[model samples]
Target chain A: MFEKKRLHPISIISHIAKQLIDTLFPLLVLVVMKARTVSLGWNIAVPTVVLLYTTLIGFFTWLRFTYQLNERELCIEQGVFLRKKRSIPFERIQGISISAGFFQRLVGVVQVRIETAGNELGKAEAILTAVTKKEAEQIARQIRKVKEGVVHDETIELINRSEQPNDIVFSLRFRDVFLLSVTSGGVFGVLAAIAAFISQLDDFISYDALYRKVQALGFVRNTLSGVVAIFVLFVVAYAISVGRHLLRYAFFTVRKQEDMIVISRGLFEKQLLTVSRKRVQGIIIKENVVQRLLGYVSVHIIHAGGSLDGGESGSVVFCPFMKKERAASVIAACLPEYHIHHEFQALPQRARVRYMLRPVYVFAIPIGMVAYVLRPWGMGLLLLLPIVSYLGYKSYQMAGWAISANQLALRSGMFRIQTIYMLKYRIQSVATSATWLQKRKQLSTLAVAVMPKMFSKVTDVDEKEAEAVYTWMQ
Target chain B: MAQLSKRISERAVSVWRIYALIRFTIFLLVYIIVCFLLMKFDGPKWVVFLLAVLFLADLFLFVLLWPRWRWQRWRYDVREQEIEIEHGVWIIKRTLIPMSRVQHVDLKQGPLLKKYKLASITIFTAATVHEIPALDEQEAEKLRHVISAFVKVDDRDV
Candidate 1:
């Protein structure tokens, strides 16, 4: 048992910095308004009073916040006037993560985040924003020991505090990060962003000026400038994507400690994420069009709870980038139970025509309306037909499902193929649905729902096969 | 499975009609109040005409037609291991909920349901919820008991 103690004194500065960031807009407005209208004496008085008020609040917040860890629970007392005390037992704690940004690293402190299953409001239950690295590591080790059924009284052998042990089960190197950046479908996103920016740019800049200028130039010059503009755009987009990948995934590492998996990464804002094996619902292997051509894959782990971005599936990247050949080895090292090599049961031959019909029907309405409204110009939009039809065919070819004694595997998608492996016990429900057209055609769609609202569906399978799956899952 | 896909109890259709009747009464009340105010203040006639058109559409669709279609489409079946429900009129939807994943079962009766001696059973899982509406009170109670017992067994096995 440890006595109650306040966080490191450096936390006061961090608290003030956090408050400044939170109230930046109002503070900026105050300064601007004061400079424009207030007299010199009033200006000095107002700024001084605001600074004093914020500093007092930060100091009191630091003085009031205290935390303690015992054999069974971690208790925290916080809030100055409100006086909130929270106690979280070891059994209820789902995960403990640590983060240290630039300032925290400079001050030799780490931010500890505790997550519990009972977080109904979808936020960290407790966050100790400033603690020594040694204290953070000790807390993590103790939690892991408790989860592994080791008695707390036992004198555990301590390792070197300065170095994280050489126990990484999976890791991404510099080359892997580069490969992921190049092939992770950044081209489409960058193109979309560029398109949106160009549309909005019209509101800011008069493009008619440039158009008239271009028209005045010779034909060859205008064509040459157009090519140069496109080339520059491509270069800029690729550089930005690759740079983002490098910063976010620098020094990415995953380690297995008993029943827990700990992942830590990042160059600027370091993120440490812990996931309990018991809570992991499934694993998904994804490969975009470019990644597939380059023989690269990324692995994601799905679990119950809101994700880091408060989205569905709570999926985190287990492996950012790996070669096709290395993917099996990585899976074996991290999750041995998930079978990487298996023959999947594909959809029947009749499903091809049905699959081709789907995209045509989906694209028809827009095409029809555009042609009806815009006449000849909309007929040019019919060019999208070939692309959508090809996508539909590819989606049909990729859609498949297979089952084993303990696991079920489903593969779907057109441009980005996703193959998910889920333990049978994790499935909450399985269903088979068919629209009136499909009912007549004797084809159905099978949907299997897992926790955290991940619904895996394989479309255009034989009705009999869908029924068999429904009964088998039960 | 074949037998379970049939429509719910015959009484549920009457229950739906009564539910629609109450809604229609509320709609009528609001319409009369608005119409009275509009005429008193000499509002535009076109606005009142548009409101009347919308109200007529609502009355024909929700009060007159939808209840019968909904009754015909709604179906549910309770199996040993899972519950299956098929619902919706234009685009029918089917859902299956496994018994092992059921966290709890609830039987609820509002004032109308109580007057009619009917209940609705709601089954809850960690991430989602499903309900089978307008069953006989005794049947709803028995289904709740059975599902809870299955949930208890599942917990014990784990």
Candidate 2:
């Protein structure tokens, strides 16, 4: 039922590097401790044993690693002394996904992932490390053909399979990518700086000393320096993000493979991700306040079983920028089943009032108490009340929910408009509740639970409307 | 097996009432011990008395409302495609789980329930938990068997 193939030779280096990175921190700690103790005998023996263990494991991994693909199954054989084999039946295989980092891209190879049903986390059932783009496509096509019994004639074909006339699918230009990179939150930049500083602690002064030095720079000098530093950080972060995005999405192309949609992109570390027509929960067309004003929207597919790694923390955005109309057309063409009407219905005024008032009352008591206790400082701090109130109101106004024939859609967030959809069958359970005030106002809050793709639950809906929808669903 | 349509046995209320009472009693005893220890350490006499009074009041309320708290009110309608559960006091919650999504169902009994020859049935969905507590052992076993058969049938159909 399953066949085996050999992994690319380059995977040996990648696997070793991965193993080294995993054990580096603990090994460093042990070395530092040995140095402080000044016991050369123990230090030498400890490091020697550690190196031997690491080398032995690395060598065994390289020796044991093997991959195979046949008509019915794909099998991966890998383990140290204890040999283990994993076989994924062709029929159960869901999709093939590819991703490559800068180093892999430099070597002109991409990592291929073969996803299967049931398992949510962990590596794809099988991975082909450092495969050429053509080879990856051939593997993906063969797997799909065996699984679905459909043969795609051309490697890349654009089909006009719609009642409406076809239009050109828009791809991100270099300028749009730059704009998105600049506007992205620079949290990754700050974290990278902190990591670098920590790693060089032995060679440099302590973080506290650095902080004191910055503080001693006086008010005007500190402010000017802070502004200059922030500006420089933003420029660097923007450039890196833009460069990465360009490298990853340079030759982006979308095409149909039978009933599935396949998107392949990237200049160096190319990726080919395919989504079955039925598996796409919904197409979310989003635009932040800035992007909305600029008439651009980002397109993302809401998949039921798979999520971007890092628990939605990383901005591994798909289609970073696109015109709203073009994005809609692409979604319609790609996934005809999930083509929802664009008309959005705002919540009732009473519901909006309840939503805005609840957040205020919840925060007001504690905030007011804190402000009163700190009144000796000044009454000016109380000015934050109006700002908080404004943000709450904006959030209430932005929150909306809509139900189409087969899809339930919810839009939320203040600065960034996030739209999510859940098909009827995928929903596991729905529960509704009403606080005393809500009950008096004839309103209820509802929460629908779905299987979490990564770590957290993906339940999104307006509280009151969700209750109504729950009742309606039942 | 006659298709079981209703909830667990009528004796469920009595069992839940006893459980609540035992829990409340334990809570009261713990509260008293903590307050007594605090007073021994010369803590605020007034605060300790107030807390003790609150605990006593809570115990009384729990005993008085035991009937309402222990009442087992559930409505289940298993159609060809889905199973719906409506239960809860004060706040009524209704959940509809499709037959396709039901992973498994189990009928379990603890030491207390074993004495009474009763069992609790749990329906496992993909994400949420639903329990039908206090069924006669035979009834529990029958429901579990029936649900398992239905789940397997639906899986094949899909």
Candidate 3:
């Protein structure tokens, strides 16, 4: 089904309009905020031109795009001016996923993405922006049938057969999302973003005047009030972070249907992604300092193709938050082949002195220069030295590695602990290195690469242990 | 120190020396341009003096010292099971890639290498690429064939 046919004409409006809104929304806000300074003619001129340009792009993009699917491969020819051709054989296809955004939902259509065992880092092989749900499902089914070497009997009402019931494997609750985001660095991230945004907003409005106005209100006067104001600010940031996390992971679910693990989440964007079980490289259970203290961890799936935009990282977050004790069972329920181990062989004692001294040596020159420049004012920054030492100590404490059967679990972190669990068969390569000092100290840094260009390393391990790992990998 | 069985061609030293010289000359040219600009603007003479000192130090450190150290450090071994590579002047890194995981092998030749009758063999596993740089052309060709032959027909989709 393809070359002569096109997606629903509404795709032009729904898909392109969403992109235009995302890109132009901030610009539009800026124009309106500065409308008084700029002439009415200029304000109207900017939006009018933007509107006309987007319309032309949308129309041409839709007019030029077409896909053709045959027994051998799926071919797509698109681009308004520069004709681009892409073909994917059925064997290379990993899976197909359907998602819907607000616009697509309004038009009762879904956006379909085709994923392959692609060499490209972070992109889907093909995307059908707007297609009927039935057609999308049929295409997915047909591709699967072809890959499985199942002969298609088109004479029968076979495509209409209901799919295997999905077994729900893992899910995230609102309470967990709230707790996860509150304790996460995300609160600080949001607060920093807001602070930076307000700082930049001076271009449109003056916050200095607003600050004086607030001072007149006596909002932040004495130390007690200042403390309370800071507290209030933190509470607001935490609230926003939780709200964002909740919306992003609302009704988050993972279900297995045959060989595919399907993940669906998001309140507005409604992302549904499928990962072929065969293509899963490994899983990493990550816990930051706060999460470790609270006994919570997040699990991420490392897939081969890495085409699915799982989250901020290439690995997809399987469960945003789970009890540290419960993580193994939760992961087992979904992917039983991997055994997540908690016990680890800690770094050698000699490594501790090296770890602790590293940060000091790195930050010494910079801190000294700053202190020299700022004198008494910057000398206060020296207080951070103790904390830096403690961080290095913590990194030494956290670093560990273990091997069981044919699987390797490597744990390393300064502030956030990540335990990468990969089977021996899945490991792409292993590299061990040591500086002259490290070699003298009998310590080596071992890096294990599971996905293309993604490496998890444990530095300052016993050279013997590193050698053992190499032997194990061999 | 652990020693790998093989070393790159001796010509690699001259190649790196030539590269370092070329790079140093560019830096010298840029410094000349900057001095001209500074003179045009009647800028500080101390600035040019400071830069000249830095450039001389750079010549000593990079153009003279680095190539020999790099050539001395680089080594590799192709075994039946895995290909091991060790390189780096200060922090020597040894990477081991099992034959089963190798995706492909490439023998690449650029203008400088061609001029010297040398080539580099790049071995790509699923995750990273390791290059044994500036080998004899025939040695690189042999390595390309050996690695390709050793690479299993079915990689575990790595």
Candidate 4:
């Protein structure tokens, strides 16, 4: 079931570059030893052997690499002397994701990622590097046809139909991008840049020379120079932030495929990603305090096995800055099962008070001890009492759980609200707990276990209205 | 098809008492070691005395609570479509697992339980775990057979 074709010879160069980076530390030591004319037999012998070993590996990699695509499966046969064959059945292929870096783009090549369902480690079944953009898309379409066949229970169609996405769900204009960049985390970047510039003054000019020069200058001149430096740093940081945001998200477009959504963007190093509709666990619409004031929201979808580099990677910003209603409508269109409710259910006031009090009581003894030990400095630590109290109150207010016919949603986090959704069938387990006080108030916490493609196995609602939920589930 | 039925004989409470006694002995040994370290490190006499008192108080509380901890209380109800278990002290917890979700069931007997003709039944599910402890051998076997039959039944009804 496998036919062999030689991989592009450029793969050898890439492989060697990777090996060189890995052996860089040992190579540096060997170079220094030879330059010093220190003839340690083992030291010279070790590096000599390593160099030969690396070169032999590169040669064998170029010889044994081959990737073939048949009608029903894609096979890759690659090894040094011992051949290793990997076959991915057409039915099991989940999605194809394409990514290109600046260097790859310059060489007219992109990295193709093939993802599959089930299992946490190495869910990206295969990765093909340095493939032409046209060839990458062709392979992606063929894999998509196979995935659709499995979902719909049909044989593959031989026709090479160009798969065009349905509609652009969300896009950010230049003005929107600029507004978002300036009002969001831009001030911190500017301050960091100013600090970095001040630290680099010795690098730019000798410390002694700069100190003497500054002493020779008048107070007014020194003040003016400082102001100019600050102004230049602010401009540089702001420009860099805005430029980076625009370059990475210039033509961001998310379109609907048959049973999946495809996100494509970037002027250079373009990336195209597909996620099955069923795999999407939830949709998070975020609006920073500034974005909220300006009536804009950013939508992100949570999907299993959709990450590009294995950890929270497949986050596609469907819309950078759009009207809340418009964003909600698009989300509804894509995920018709989830209905956006105007009024979210909040925990009861009594429950909120108990939740806030529990943390305060838990920290009171330790806080008091620290205050006694520190004396005058302890006065500063007293401020933490109110901060902890406020966070507890906010967490209580933000925590809520809701269950629909087919899904369960748990909302948490104070400043950044995260609403996690899981299908009823996907839930591996449900655990409920009640602390001593919670038992008194008849309140309990519920944790729902889910098998995400990576990281945390469980997402829970702590100290929420659990009795009512327990009754409902029962 | 023929049906099988078995009855389980109840065991004595001395078995649980012995288990609690062993646990208490271990806790006492750990407490003594910690106290010895504190005294050897030149800790304040008053502080060491207060810790000793606290340790003694905890031991007394455990002794008083031993009966409640060792109480052989468990309930298992196998209905037409689900298995329900209610257990725990101070705070009771109830779990209901649909028969369709039960992957398997096991009947285990320890040396002490084997001598007393008693066994324990653990029902495995995809999501939840439930166990019935201190059941007589006949009841344990009957429960295991019934659960296995239900586990084999088609899950479509769930």
Taking chain B only, the TM-score of every model is: 0.84, 0.76, 0.92, 0.71
> Which pairs of residues collide in model 3?
none
Clashes of each: 0, 3, 0, 0
Evaluate model 3: give its TM-score.
0.87
Q: Which stretches of candidate 4 lie over 4 Å from their true place?
A: A1-92, A121-123, A132-148, A151-166, A175-250, A266-268, A285-298, A304-322, A358-381, A401-409, A420-431, A449-468, B1-158
Each prediction's RMSD over C-alphas, in Å, is 6.4, 7.2, 4.5, 9.5
For each model in turn, which proportion of the native inter-chain contacts is also found?
0.46, 0.46, 0.82, 0.05
Clashing pairs in 1: none
Cα lDDT tens digits, model 4, A276-358, are 67766556565554555676667776665546434355444556667777865887777787755434456666677765666
Instruction: Encode model 2's per-residue lDDT on A1-474: one tens digit a residue.
Output: 234455555676677677777777556666675575567777678767876777777666766887776666767788877888887876776556666755566676667766665565443566676677666666766666775643222222321232122332445566666665554424444446444534544453356865687678754565467569667765654566657656656656565556656555667545555555555544556667667777777776655444432224211244667777776667666666565555655655666665566567766777778677546442555666676677667766766666788566666665566666666666666655554455566555455655433111112234556556765565
Candidate 1 lDDT over residue span B1-158, tens digit each: 25355446667777888888898889889988998899999988788889889989888888778888888888888777888888877555677787788888889999888888889999877657888888888888988887777664454211
* Arranged by lDDT, best first: 3, 1, 4, 2
Q: How high is the CA lDDT of each candidate model?
A: 0.75, 0.61, 0.79, 0.61
Q: How accurate is candidate 2 locally (lDDT)?
A: 0.61
User: What are the per-residue Cα lDDT tens digits for candidate 1 across A117-164?
Assistant: 657534778889888877877776767667774222111121221136
User: Can you write out model 3's per-residue Cα lDDT over B1-158, one digit (the tens) per residue?
Assistant: 35788999989988998999999999899999999999999999999999999999998888888888899888999977889999998898999898888888888999999999999998887788889999999999988888877877554463
Best by lDDT: 3
In the range B1-158, model 4's lDDT, one tens digit per residue, is 01112222335244554566678788778777877887899766786677678767765555555444534334457755666565555544445565665768888888887888888888765434567777878878987888887765443211
- As a whole number from 0 to 100, the lDDT of residue A448 in candidate 4 is 56
> Order the candidates by TM-score, highest first — what do you get?
3, 1, 2, 4
Q: Score the docking of each candidate (DockQ).
A: 0.44, 0.34, 0.70, 0.12
